[model samples]
Structure formats: structure tokens, C-alpha cells
Target chain A: MTDSINATGADGGLGGFFQNLTDSIISQIPFWQDVLLPALWDGLWVTMQLVVMTAPLGFLLGLLIAVSRVYGSAPVKWLAQLYVIFFRGCPLLVLLFILYFGLPSVGIVLGSFMSALVGFILCNSAYNSEYLRGALQSIKRGQLLAARSLGMTKMQGVMYVVVPQALRRALPGVSNEFIYLIKYSSLAYVVAVIELTGAAKIIASKYFMYFEAFAAVGIFYLVIVTIATIGIHRLEMKYAIPGVSGAVGKVSKGH
Target chain B: MFESISAVTNSAGYLLEGVGVTLLLVGLSLLIGFVCGIILTLGQVYGPRFARWFVGIYVWFFRGLPNIVLLFLFYFALFPFMGLDLPAFGVAVVVLGLRSAAYQSQIFRGAIQSLSEGQMLAARSLGMTKWQAIRSIILPQSLRLSLPGWANEYPVLLTDSSVAYVIGVAELLTRTSQVISRTGEPMILYLTCAIVFILLNYGGMMIIQYVEKKVRIPGFGNNEAECL
Candidate 1:
């Protein structure tokens, strides 16, 4: 009984709690040193790969959707609208699941990585199309008329005049979408692509240092998002027209 | 596809059961999320500098991390330390609600900020206390203005609720996947889930549109029509 009391005195005191806290923090360092850093780099690489592949594809798809909505026949326009609404309305996570799990059974198996990439591209395009369409509409009808009066063909006018201006005006919204896409890519883990968040989860499970592992992942995301924000701001400044720069300048400045 | 439909219909009851769980998750999370949102908004807009900073970090952490990661962190990491036992539904609600608060705070902050300063000044000139002025004037207008954003966020929350499936919440998509795994009819089950999701989203949007039509400022769009 005396020995039991002595052991309890050592174990069940403030010192024990402090010791455990110190151990938790100490155990986390090796996790950061060995597993966290490599996983972070791998995750960052995969995230960049998704972004690079999807951005252009998503933009092209968005451009096509915008053109179809604006210039195509009524049925085509209706179809475009339906596509945007359905995709934008549903969550990307659900879309990812359908592509990864649902489509395979139909004998339409997309490799897991491709499934995540394609799903993200489709959803991002749907959203980007809406922003592009809105930006296109916001450009005055006078601009198109002015281009036509300059003896440019309809296609030439759109390519040379309307698109360049619309893209500039759409930069802020597109940048916002890019930030969203970066964070959204984390959802790829659900479909088992072993992206950053997935990598963090594996490390956390392995080390039992969930706080440190996930906190590192969060810090990495914050750095990327912050950098993206600054880069987009610079791009916005470079492309902004003189007179209409005020509103765009204001929003970006506040950020 | 036809074979897939027959398989899906066979498991319709199970899928509906999943939908029930999804709805419950959405309802409970939204309730808790909205309350947290209001408190956070109040803190950012009216509290001391330190309070604002604290709230800002809360929003940043929750919003920056992915929902799945957040769910895992809470369920696996925090729950064990707290030693408070809760079921899967409780954990789902807490995680989703906490994340939703971060997003809703930004939405509310933007709505509140959009109100003209003159109105608040006018209320102050009439001897109303700051809180009184906000309660009587600012909040009413801000709430109406925020309805559209809030409407959009509902479907977002609904779709996000699917993360609950990972933690075994048995939501719609999870149940549908289970059915497909059992019957080997993925096409129909997945398509049904997608269609049901689309319908729910559209339904929410329609309600928002109705509210928007009711509350729209009468003179706002008149200038565009005149210019046209």
C-alpha cells in the first residue's frame, strides 16, 4: 500500500501532466523532421500538378462554355446554362466521389489521380464559365459594335478585342477561383489520391502527433494561399486598364 | 444503364435512409453554425482589437484546412484528449458547424459592411446607443442583404455534409456507394445521387430567388432598363 501510494504520488500530479505535454511536443519534432517535410514536398508537388493541368483545361472549357452561351443557338445556350448550374450547385466532393467510385462500375474507370483531376477540372470550368460569362456580359454592347465598325469580322472582333478585355476584367474573380481550387484540391484525399491532406493524415496516424502534423499542413496551405494572393494582385495591377482600375484596385487592396 | 436502375430501385429504401441522415446533419450543423457565425461576426465588427484578432485566427484555421482534415483532427485528435464521449453524429455536427462558422462570418461581415455609413450616423444623431443603433437599423438591412449569399451557402453546406460519410455518418453518397458495392450497379446509384443533389440545390436556389424578388430594392435595376 505504501509503495502504491508513492507510485501514485509520482504519476498523478501536475508534474505528470507537464511531462506528458513535454513528451507530446518532443515526439512531434521527429515527425516534422522525417515524415512531415517530405510529405509536404510531395503534397505540394501534387497540388501544383493538379493546378497546372486543370487551370488551362478548365479555362479552355470555361471559354468554350462562355462562347456557347453567348454566341451559340438557343438550345446550345440552354445546355451551357444547365451545365454551369448543376456543377456549381453541387459540392465538388460529391462530384469527386461520383467520378472516382461511381463511374468505375460503369466500365468507365478513370485512374484515381485522373479521376480527381478530371472531376476538379470539370467543376472548376463550370464555375469559371459563370464568371467569364458575367464578365463578358458586363462589357458594353458598344465595344462589340465598335469592333465590328472597325471592319473586323465577328470572330476577329471577339478574339482581338472582346476576349482580351473580358479576361482582364475577370482576373480578380479568376484569382479567387484559383485560391478556391488550391484549397479544394485537398478534397482529392477522399478519392484516395494521397495529396497533401492525405499525406498529413497518414503521418498523423503513424506518429500519433495529429496536432503538429496537421498544423504543419495548415501552415503550408497558408503560405501558398498568401503567395497566390500576392501574385494575383501583381497580375491584376499589370493588366488593369486606367479608368476602370479604381474598383478592382479597392477590392485587391483591402485583401 | 437499365440494369443499373433495377439495382438502384432495389436499394431505394437504404438510400432514402441515408438521405434522412444527410438532412439531419445539415439541419443540426446549420443551426449551430449560424449561431457561431453571429457571435464571430459580432466580435469582429464590435469587439476589442484582441478579440477581433482571436476571432480572425479561428476563421483562418477552420477555413484554411480542408473539411476532411478538420473532421479527422477533431474526431481523432481532440476527442481523445477531452475524454468526453460523443457519437459520430455529434462529432460531424461539431466539426461541420465549426467550419461553417468561419465561412458564415465572412459572409455576414461583408453584408454588414455594405450598408451605408450614413444610416448608422443618422441613428446615432437621434440619441440611440451604439448597440441600439445596430440592433434597430444595421442588422435588419444587413440580414436582408445577406440572404442571397446565405442561400448560396446552404447548398455548399449540403454538399460538404458528405464528408460525414468518411466518419461513417452513412449520408446519401456513402449509402449509394454501399448499395453499388453490394449490387454492382454503380451507374444508376451514382447518377441518382447526383440528380438528387442537383434537385436539392435548385430547390434551395428557388427559395432564395423568391426571397430576393420579395426584398429587392425597387429602384436598383430601373437605371439599367432606362439606359438600355
Candidate 2:
């Protein structure tokens, strides 16, 4: 009934035909106008915060763990290994549930956002550590020896000579991990953080505009990922070492 | 501790059923991914410019977006728009599989790239067509090379399957959440789910690692293999 009426309203004009089509499509997904889009923007903001906070902290933790694993005493190595295994083996959702829901049972209560952050940091750090460890190991022993010959102690050798090169080599992998964080940060919604995906789910259900709502969310992620991909490419070129095979090679080595 | 054990026992059947769903989801998706991934890899490596561009855009969208968002998009939007009334389980499998295809394609592309171009040239010189060269010469070695990296995907897919719970796929995480709600034992239930997932993660990885070991050419790419 409404379809024919709208078609007739087009008045045999091309402009009206396109306008009619747009209006009909928009009418069916009316929630797009006042509700879901705004919710998604808010969710995008939360997602951004999660990624920003988690990236630096996670990278720092990963670097510490990796260094300890590579150069620490036996106990330190054992502890770092355990941390990596535990965090890496656990599914992120389960880890988040443990942090947000389970911990309160044992008198450690974290709010949803904090729980999501902690879970992300732990998981992110463990994976990042793996990459860093691989990079650390790939550095030639001659570099360390050269540092030692220069009157530097083992710690200083690592800190000055080894770590700089390792970090430089590790940039590609680290940035790849950061891109993953941008996507995985959507899981924050599971713990009630109301990030982008969560916002889409709520609006989709509330307004039954599943197609438009989720499509908009997908666009948001696509935009972030495009930016990340370009940024990572630039970083790879900037940090590229002659004869090192560059970003894709180094990053893929992490996996 | 005894009470916690009892709670686990009480829900053991449901949890096992959940594991079945998880495996079903993972297995089907991995199958779909393997098929689609190969096509995508081939497209990127040897196809014409248009095909390569198509593959690039497909991989970019699938890889760039979050799995959860992709899952939601498929489960809620795409299928419904297409007038398909598939169950949540079906939607989960398709979404995970397609998303995985993107990553798997990259893995396969790397493996294919590691191969020397001489193989294809040799195949062509031997009077083989381009398609024949790919099928006979290029694929076997690259497929073998892809195994080690491909094995890594198992754990990744397993971890990602937990997100299916958002759409009520009744997987392991969903089952554990249900048990927690009923028994008010979030810690034990959640821990049990974690242990199960970890077991799957490590166990699956170990099996794939074994396959990799069997298929590996000893001196072909040992340095790279060890680094990975």
C-alpha cells in the first residue's frame, strides 16, 4: 500500500525517483535518524578510550615480560613464561568475565570498564611479549658482545645496545598488535562497557533496525582499521632497516 | 572446594554439550576458511588486477573489522536482509569462517610467497598451463609450508568462538554464564570454562604442531619456522 503511494509521489521525475528510494529505505530504518547513530558515536568514543589506554600500558608490560624472559634469572624466566601461557591460553571473554564477575566473589571487585581494561592489558601484554621475545632473540649476539667490550655490564648492554635495536625491529610487530587491539577492544562491551558493538546491539534490538545499525558500526570499525593500516605502513617505512625485509616479514614472525 | 567440584560435575553435561557446539562452529568455519582462504590467496598471488583488488578489499574489510562486529553484522543484518532465517549457529559459523578466511588468506599468501618463482617457471617450461602450474607445482609446496602457520589459526578461532555467545549460540562461555547465574558461583564456573578453553587451545595447538612437524621440509625454511 505505502510502496505504491510513494512510487506515485515520485511524479515521473528522476530526482523524485531517487528521493523516493532514499526516503523509503530510511523510513524502514527510522531509528537511524535520532537514536542509533548517536549511540554509536558515544560508543565509538568509549572504544577509542579503551584502545588508547590499553595500547601503551600493554606494550610496556609486554616489553618488561619479554626482557625478563630473555635475560632474567631462572625464577624470573619461569614467572614470565607462566604469565604468557596463562594469559595467552585463556579466551579473552572468559578472562573478562573472571575480572568483572568472578572476582567479586573473591573480594576483588573491579568495575566493568576497569575489568575490561585489565583483561585487555593482560591478554595484549602476553601476545606482545611473544613478539618482543622473538625480536629480542633475533638480535645477533655480536651486538651484545660489542656492548660488553665497550665496558658495559650485562644490564647496561641490554638496555643500551640490545634493546634499541630490538625495539626498532619490534616496531612492526608492536604496531600490528596495536591494530588487533583496536578490533578486540570491542569485547569491552561484554563486560558492560557499552562500546561500539554494544551500542549497535542495543539500538538494533530496541529499534529493530538491525541492518542499518550494524552496518554503521561496521563502517566505524572499517574507518579505524583503515587509519591504522596506513599508519602502520608509514611506521614500517620510517623504521625500516636496510636489508631487513621490513614490516610484513617482521610482524609475521611474531605469529 | 568440594562444593565447587560438585557444581562443575552438576553442569558437566551442559558444558560438554557447549563444547560440541563450539567444536561444530570452529570446525565448520575452519573448513569454510580453508576453502575461501585458498581462493583468496590464489587471487592475490596470481590473479589479474581486478581480482587482486577484489581480494584486497575483501581481506581488508574482514580483517580490519572486529570479529564481534562482523558476527553481529552477519547475524543481524546481512542474512535478514537476504531473507534468510538461519539459526544463530549457522550465522556464527558463516561469520567466523569468512572472518577467518581473511586471516587465513594472508597466511596462505605468505606461504605461497616463500616459494621460489622457479617452480612455476619450470612447470610452464614443462608445457603446463598456468592453472596447471598452480595446481600441480605451486600448491603442494605452499600448502605444506602453510601448515605451521595455519595450525596457529586453530587456537585463534577457538578463542574467538567465545564471542558467539553474544548471539546466544549456547557455546562454552554461554553455558558457563548460565551456570553462574543459576548457582551464584561465578568464580568456579568461569574458571572451569577458562580451563576447558585453555585445554582446547593448547591441545589443538599441539596437534597442529605435530602436523606441522610431519609436513615440514627439514632445511627448506627451518630458520623462519623456528623464529615463528
**Chain B TM-score for all candidates, comma-separated:** 0.90, 0.95
Give per-model TM-scores: 0.88, 0.92
DockQ per candidate: 0.42, 0.53
* Per-residue lDDT value at A224 in model 1: 84
In candidate 1, how many Å is residue A123 off? 0.7
Model 1 per-residue lDDT tens digits across residues A116-189: 89988998888778667767767778888999998989898888877777777777777777877887888887
Regions more than 4 Å wrong, model 2: A1-33, A241-255, B226-228
Pairs that collide, model 1: none
Candidate 2 docking category? Answer: medium
Cand 1, B chain, TM: 0.90
**All candidates' lDDT scores?**
0.76, 0.84
